[model samples]
Target chain A: MTIKEKSEAIVEEFAIFDDWMDKYAHLIELGKELPIIDEKYKDESHLISGCQSRVWLHADYVNDNVVYTADSDAVITKGIISLLIRVMSDANPSEIYSSDFTFIDDIGLSTHLSPTRANGLVSMVKQMKLYAKALYLRAEK
Target chain B: MGFKINSIRNDFPVLSTKVNGKQLVYLDNGATTHKPMQVIDRISNYYMTENSNVHRASYNLSHIATDLFENSRKFIANFINAASYREIIFTKGTTESVNLVASGFSDIITEGDEIIITVMEHHSNFVPWQQLCKKNKATLRFLSVLKDGTIDLSELLAMINSKTKLISITHISNVLGTINPVKKISEIAHNNGVPVFVDGAQAIAHANVDVSEIDCDFYCFSGHKAYGPMGIGVLYGKEEWLNRLSPYQYGGEMISSVNFKSTTFNELPYKFEAGTPNVAGALGLERSLRYIQDIGLDNIFKYEDDLLQYATKKFENIKGVMIIGNAKSKIPVISLNIEGLHPYDIGILLDQMGIAIRTGNHCAQPLMEALELPGTLRVSMALYNTKEEIDLFADALMKAIDMLT
Candidate 1:
């Protein structure tokens, strides 16, 4: 899917507004819909720190393309994790390197999070994309 | 389990207010307590009527402010049953207080020394010592908590060695509500020739704390957690240890004689105080303490005890609501996850009903890992909390769980 399509999907996923509770339920539903990663991608190295939730995320290089898979114990976190995997998972190493996550602003995301939580979410995204970038660099060499 | 519920509810403004057009039920006291009417008035009065810098000024306003500030220290010292007023040092909150000790006590941590902590400490207590040990080439040791959430005393006793420098334990586990026997732990640490620093952030609000009874080298707590204003807290250090540990910060008011040649520090308390402190915040804390004392700590404790027992029974009756940290000696807080429901979702749904609860790890990441579960919904209790609030929480939680399932 195109980046615009993926971004729109995320916004649609979070569009529920009955309350923060329903909002989170929808997020967990989004996580439930996350496409599975290949079994080989599950390993020890991809876990994110600073989250009480255990999230293992991995990206792979196939035919000069990157695909991502992630899993989390907490459904709400998993939904965000799914959104993250969709946003930064696939595409070229160069795109991964140069792209900014500025689209999150349009979705009115991060506003609900405290400063620390928002920063932690940023760190999680950064760490994931950096991992994908590493794989891309290795293949190019 | 009932004790003048309606009148007590009115004392806390948050309880009287409506959220999303619904009555507010606050069950997040472990995070922080909602201030009472008197405490609120005291804080407002300070800003409106008595706004002045404290100490070292020879003016009337300064003298009054200084008296208020010092009186606050005496109030808190008396609240905790400390021997003297000089024992209390104010900081931003419990986090800063713990960091102060970790940073200051680094002056004595010889190479190859160790710091003993428990697995259940909030990151505030854990990370500071981890950083300190790492910086000083010392080993950081964690005494483990059992499945029931209580620490194994024998195991911790084994961990203490000649190299063990300090035992820093949380008096009450924020996430689990597990109350550690600090007096016993302090005894063991003292036996091993190591001092103990008790983090009383969660305990001070719920239980009576006598620093002399605990007999530890250092103790720390926050005023916010005890129905007071935020951004101010207390650090109680033994006089000998306070005299021995170097000051963490350097600034005005902390110095005695500074000449062109060199700078000399002031005496105890002021030596660590460093700067002109939060005068109003300190007084507000003093008021909060008096409020607690007036309600009678024993009376409040008994009331909360009834509420927690009622809550536990009420929660257990709800299908698929599983409580965590079933330690025999626990405070009122309860962490539980509904079968197949996320804690955040539950917290959100409940918030819409004008009920406030905490979700996420509650800042005990390591304990979450050990539990092998995601974050749980934490229903923490305060002395002012009633069984009615717990009923509302149970009703909302069940409703949320049903929606999720």
Candidate 2:
């Protein structure tokens, strides 16, 4: 599925939960199912700063697509990271790079993307896009 | 003069608010405190009627502003029981106050001179001295904390010598809430011929601080942390030290006379305070201090201690909850970590329940490294907080843990 399709699906999934607690519970469940990055990539080189919780993100370019893997020490941050990875991963570099990821706001988790939140979700998204942009530029060259 | 919790709660307008459909339980007093109605009104009144550039104009408004501003210095000097108002040099806040002193010392500290600071100091206190030592080619030594988050006096005594030029310590640890023996430390430092600078940012509101009694060369605290306005802090120095140290900044108000070639500096307090000061902030701060005085620090201390004990007992029974900093002497601050859950997760969940707390290193990264933990959730209470609020927080914490687990 395309990034938009996956994000919409997740939004729909989240829409079923009327209460904030249920929404958080769903996020927690999703956090457990995150595509774990290799332990080797979980070092300082892969670490994303500006977060209260430690987040490490790794990206791989394969089959003309970018695949993302990430982890966070905080489960709520991890949950947010899981959603971001699910939305942006397995897409071409240009597609991942250009997407604004407005679904975060649509799903009422926009606060996580705010710089003040400092949960690394904002940094994670930025890093993901930067990686995709770098790959896209290299491919153009 | 009675400790009326309800009336005191009413004094703070923000306490009546709600967050996320629940009553707001503000427990992050360590970060900054909400201003009482009196402090708020004081600032508003200053801006409305007494708005003028102090120490400059000859107008009536300016005179009123100047008197209010100068009176704030005197009030603060008296509040901390300093020798005179000249000892009270107003700066931006505690961080700026520390920086001002550190900047002055940078010139005096020579090669091989040492500065001792505890590992539990906030970044504001830790960074300035570290940079000062580095720039002057001096040594920076850290006094390690014991298991219960208290420092051993023997270790401090052993660390000081002829080479030790200064010892900057916090009156209370922001993260651990351990109240250090500032008086004892000051005595030790003075005996060793080393000046002591106490960072009273955390202690100023929670306890009564007398700079003269402590006999520390320098003591500093932020106004906002103590029920006052932001952007105004006090740097209390001995008259001799204030005279000896050079100005931190050079500008309009801090100068006696200025020429194209050279400039002569102003007297104590004014020398450190350059440019147009935060006159309104100072007035607000003075009013807040007065409010505290009327309430009485002893009464405030007793009430907070009861809240701390009540909260501690509740958290002690919770499974997998580890309370950090079990120091015998502490204010109403508690830092805790769950067995497997992260502090950020707990903090976010608690916020949803309208319970505000501080998470992460609390700006004491070295302390976190020493403790071998990432960070912990901290709940710092104040005069406005109550046992009922603590009970609510404890319940929310358990629910958050259950959900996360």
Candidate 3:
């Protein structure tokens, strides 16, 4: 599915749960299903700073598309990162740079996030886009 | 509970707040405390009528302000049983209090000198000494805590030698809730001819603190933690030490006289206070101290101890709940984690259920490293908290755990 289609699908899935508990349960399930990043990529270099929890994210370009894998010591953070990875991963670099990424707000994730977690989410999105831009520039070179 | 806790809790207006359609169960006392109505009213009264710049102003308002401000220091000095009111120097908070001492002691702390602190100190207590030692070419040594979170007293005594110039330690571990034997520690430091600075930020409100009884050279604590207003803290130094140590900051109100060639500083207390102080905060702090005194420290300690025991038993029985900081002597603070469950997840879930708890390293990253934990969910209680709140917290935590695991 396209990045927008994937975000819409996730939003629709979240809409099924009326209770915060059930939504978190769904998030936890997503966390458990998150594709584990390689042990080598779990180093400090790939770690995102300023998060209350530790999140290690790694991205690589394949056929001009960015493939991202990430992990967090925190289950909720892991679940949240999975959303970003699913939406932006395997998308064209230009598409990632141009995408509005309104699914976070549509799913009411931003409003529910604590200030610290909100910052972490922003950093994750920023990192994903930076990876795409770098790969696009390298492809040009 | 010996005291009328329900009535006492009513004095705190924030206790009646509802979060997410549930009664607010505030358990983040270690971060800061909710002020009583008396304190809030006192602050308002100061701003409304007694509002004026303290000292240097020849007016009725300034006189009233100065009287209230100075009386606040005197009241706090008496509250802590300091040697004299002159020994009490006000600062922004505990951080600034420690920084003042660390900066003032720089002249005496020379190259090859040593400073000793514990592994469980909050960053406020740890960072200043660490940076001072680094800048002064001194070695900063840490007394390791045991697995159960209590500091190794014998080990700390052994570490002190002629090379040790100063010893600064926390009276209570913010994360561990371990109450260190400051009096005993002070005795050892004095025997070694070393001055001791006690960070009483966590201890002052929960228990009675007497600088005279402890015999520590210096004691510092924040007013907010003791149900006072923020931006005001107390630093009690021995008269001799206060006289010998140079002022950390130089500005108005701290100088006796100013000249282009050389400036002479003011006397004790004023020498340390370099600017227009937080007069209203000081007044509010006095009112807070009065409120706590009315409740009585012994009574407060007894009530909180009972609450801790009950909560500890409840949490101990919960499956998958691992209670960290199992110190034999502790206050109501309890840090815990569930097997395979992140602290942030538990904290957020509990907040949704109308309970407030602190998560993460709590500004004690080195302590977290030593304990080998990413972080913990800490439920710290104050005098106002009751057993009912603990039950609600446990119920919410269990539900969160069930949902996650």
Candidate 4:
């Protein structure tokens, strides 16, 4: 699916929950079900240190598409990472680079995305886009 | 006068507010406190009526502003039992206050000179000395913390020698809530002919601080942490020490006379205060200190101690909940982590439940390293917080844990 389509689907899924409890519960479940990254890539080289939590993100260019895997010490942050991965992973680097990811605000989880929150999600998103942009430029070269 | 919890809570207008559709239960007083209407009104009144640059002009408004600002210095001196108001130098906050002293000491410290600090110090107290030592080719020693998060004075004594020029320690550990024996530390340092500096950022609001009684050569604290306005802090030093050190910043008010050739520095306090000062912030801080005085620090100490004990007992009952700092002498701050849960997760979940707490290293990374953990959730209480709020917090924590698990 396209990045926009995948984000819209997740937003629709979140819309069924009326209260914060249900929304958070869904995030927690998603966190538990996240595709675990390889133990080797969880080292300091991939580490993104936030004041509140730590995130490790690894991306690869394969079959002319970008594949992303990530992890966080905080489950909520990991859950948010899972959404970003769902929307951007397995897409072309140009498609991933151009994607806005405004779905975070649309789904009412914008607070977690704030730079002040310092959960590493904001930095992780930036790192992901940077990876895509670098790969796209390299391929063009 | 008796301690009136109801009226005290009412004084803080933010207490009545709600968050996330639930009544707000603010337990993050360690970070910064909610200002009372008294302090708020004082600040607003200063900006409203008495807005002028102090110590500059001979105009009526400037004189009024100068008087108010100088009176605040006097009030703070009395509040901390300093020898004189001239010993109190105003700065932006505790960070700047510590940096100011550190900057002055850079000239005094030479190669192989030693400076000792505790592992439990906040970064504000830690980084300045570290960088100073690094720059000057001096030695920086850290006094280790015991398992109970208390400092071992014997270690401190062993670390001090003729080579040791200074000992900088926190009066209270911002992360561990360990209240050090400042008087004893000061005595130890003085006996060894070394000057001691106390970071009283956490202690000034929670406990009674008598700088003369402590006898430390230098002490500092932030006003925001003590229920006052931000951007205002106090640095109290011995008259001899203040005279011995060079000025940290060179600017307008800090000079007696200036020319292209050279300039003469101002007197004790103003020498350290360089720029146009935060006059309104100083006034607000003085007013907040008065508010604390009216409530009585003894009463605040007793009230907060009871609350800490109550919360500790409640937290101890929960399985897998580990209280990080187990010091016998602690203020109303508690750091804890549940088994198999990250502090960030707990902090986020608690916020959704309309509870505010502090998580992460609490800006004491060395202490966190010593404790061998990522971070712990901290709940710091103030006089305005009540038993009911604690009960609510306990319930919300359990619910958060349940949901996470």
Candidate 5:
């Protein structure tokens, strides 16, 4: 399935269950389906601090577009990270910069996060974009 | 003997209430405690009858308000066994208190000075010192905790030297419940001419906190954690040191004179309180403190200690539930994880059963990383908690474990 189709399917599953307890299994399953990232990028430089669940994110700048690979220690957070990578990977720096992540609310899973956790999520995405922006800016320089 | 657990429950009316048809067994007291009726009445009465700005007013209402505000300061000084009322400086809460010290000392703490804190500190104690060190080009080092959750004393002693300027620490582990050996640590710092600051946020309610007994340079605690009002906290500095540190904020109350060209700050405690203080909250805090005093802190501590012992035994009986932080000295906080379940899921399940617990890292993310766990369900205790409540919590946990595992 296409990334959009899989994302839509994930979004649809969220609607099918209101209780987080009921949705937890599906969320863990989502994490299970995420492809293992290459061993080369799994290092300290890509580590995200302040997460109870460990998250490592790496971006490869191939031909001016960003390809993202991510993993998390917690199954549910990994799933969320996979969903994030699928939506964000391969997007151009300008497109990623201009895009609104209101898809968080659209998918109806934003409320499941605590305010601090939501802030951390925004921070994580911001960092990924920052990595892309810096790489693009360096190339330009 | 007159106070059965149920009878004592009247002091906390929130316990009797139902949330989503579940009885609220609030085990999250270490996070923030519920207010007693005396505290509630005192706060409401301040707003309703004696509402006025203090220290600068002379009206009848203002006189009463001013008197009450000063009385609260005295009450806090007495509560913490400070030498005099001048030692206590009121701020918004523990975070504000720490920020006050960090900001105030920034001028004096030169680039080479070293600041020490512990691993178990809430971000309040850790971050302010970190920012202070970062700003001044100094070093921020932590006293690591043992596998059993006690402070690594040898490591702490080795780290302290002539260059070490301050030792900031938490009195009790909000997550681990391990009571640090502050007195011994204080002795080491003092011998080396380094001052220590104890974050008494979690300890004030659980145990007796004597500034003189600990002999630390500074101590801070929030009122909310001790069954007092929110938005009010105290910073206790030794008279000599408090006299030396400059003001953190520049404003009306904290200063003696502010002319067009320059300004002079007030003496000691007033030098720290910058704005109009939380008068009502202070009044409420005093009442709550008086209530605790009347109940007897030693008695309360013994009772909770017993309850902790009982709860620990019961927790050990449960299968696949790993109880974290087995320090030799601990309060009633029980941090545990049921295998194969997220801490959030355990908290949600417990919430559904009417038990309130903190599910996340409990604001000590570094400790969580050190423990190599996502998070643990923290069931912290207060004076009012009973063994029966723990039994209820354990039964709920057993059910949660069944569902999750």
Candidate 6:
């Protein structure tokens, strides 16, 4: 499925929970299932600074698609990163770059997020797209 | 010393607010405080009844506004025990208050002079001096925090020498909640012939601040921290210092007369206040100070002291709950990091459970770096907060830890 479709799927799933408590529970569940990043990639070089929570993101280029791995010390931050990964992992670099993260707004996650968390979310998205852009440039070369 | 908790809670309307289907347990008083209905009503009343430009017109409305504005200055002067109301200059907040001093001191600080501040100072208190020192080609010396988060007073005294121009320090640290000995340090600074500036942003609200008692040359505090309005802060300087230093800003309200070639500035407080003052904010802050006076700071101090001890004991029983600041003398703010768990995660989960706590550096990056902590979860208390709320916060924190692990 396309990244947009996968994002839509997330929005649809989120729409099922009316209460914030239930929605957070859903997020916690998602956080629990986030794939563990390799120990080697969890170094300071891959770390995303300026986040209240410590988040590490690492990318690998497989064939023509860019794959991403990330982890955060915080559960909600981990859930947020996992959501982005679910939508954009194994996707083309151009597709990742063009993505606007409207899915977060559509799922009402942006509004629900605390100001600090929202900032962290923005940084996470930027880092992911940056990785994609780097890979895209390498592929073009 | 009778202090009623329930009625005190009732004064703050936001205390009754429910978040995520649970009663809000706000423990983030260090960031800012919840305004009482008295302060809110005073602000509304000022706009509704006395909305006039102060010190501009001889009209009745303007007269009333000017009276209210000057009365606030007097109230704050009396509150902090300044020698005179003329010594109190109104600024935006503590940050601006510190900036005003830093700007005024810039001319006096020559090359190779030193400005000393503690590592635990808020960025507002730290950054201005840093910039001022850099601009003046002076050195900025930082007093290190002890293991218990208190400043080493002996070490601080040893560092002070002939080159030291000014010594600025926080009365109470925002992150660690360590209450520094201002009076003692002021004496030491005076002995060294250096002026002292006390950043009372965290200290003013939690306890009584008497400039006379402390004998500090400069003491500054924000109104919002003391359950008052934002955009109105009090900067109390000794009349001697106020007369000597130049005005920080030049504008309408600050000038006595202006000409094509030369303009003479207004005297004392007026010289410092630049533009048309925040009359509404000043009145609201006056009422807020009156509110605190009505409740009494000593009573508030005693009540919060008991609450802090209770909360500390409760957290002590929790596994892996490592508190960063265990100062011998401190306020109610508790900054902690749980083992194998991040503060951000705890803050998020606590927030979800209708508990409000500040998580991160709390703007004291130097102190955080010194302590080797990425960040911390800070739970600061106010007079309105109760033991029951702390119980709820502790319970929610335990539940959050369970979920995260």
Judged by DockQ, which candidate is best? 3
**Could you give me the TM-score of model 2 versus the true structure?**
0.97
Candidate 3 chain B: worst 10 consecutive residues by lDDT? Answer: B1-10
Position B181, candidate 1: lDDT: 94
* Cα misplacement distance, residue B288 of candidate 4 (Å): 0.7
Reproduced native contacts, each prediction = 0.32, 0.68, 0.64, 0.68, 0.05, 0.64
CA RMSD, predictions in order: 3.8, 1.5, 1.4, 1.5, 4.4, 1.8
- Regions of model 3 farther than 4 Å from truth: none
The DockQ-based CAPRI class assigned to model 1 is acceptable
For all predicted structures, in order, the TM-scores are 0.86, 0.97, 0.98, 0.97, 0.83, 0.96
Worst 10 residues of 6 chain B by lDDT: B340-349
Name the better of 1 and 2 by lDDT.
2
Candidate-wise lDDT, in order: 0.82, 0.91, 0.91, 0.91, 0.83, 0.90
Q: Largest TM-score belongs to which candidate?
A: 3
Looking at model 1, how many pairs of residues clash?
0
Q: Against the true chain A, what TM-score does chain A of candidate 4 give?
A: 0.91
Q: Model 1, B1-46: lDDT tens per residue?
A: 2346577667887767777678778888899998888988998898
Q: What is the C-alpha lDDT profile of model 4 across B71-114, one tens digit per residue?
A: 99999999999999999999999999999999999989999999
Please give the TM-score of chain B in predicted model 4.
Answer: 0.99
Q: Docking category for candidate 4?
A: medium
TM-score of chain A of each: 0.79, 0.91, 0.96, 0.91, 0.81, 0.96
List-wise, what DockQ does each model earn?
A: 0.30, 0.66, 0.73, 0.66, 0.16, 0.64
* Candidate 2 lDDT by residue in tens digits, B275-389: 9999989999999999999999999999999999999999999999999999999999999989999988888888888999998899999999999989999999999999999
Off by over 4 Å in 6: A12-26, A29-33, A36-45
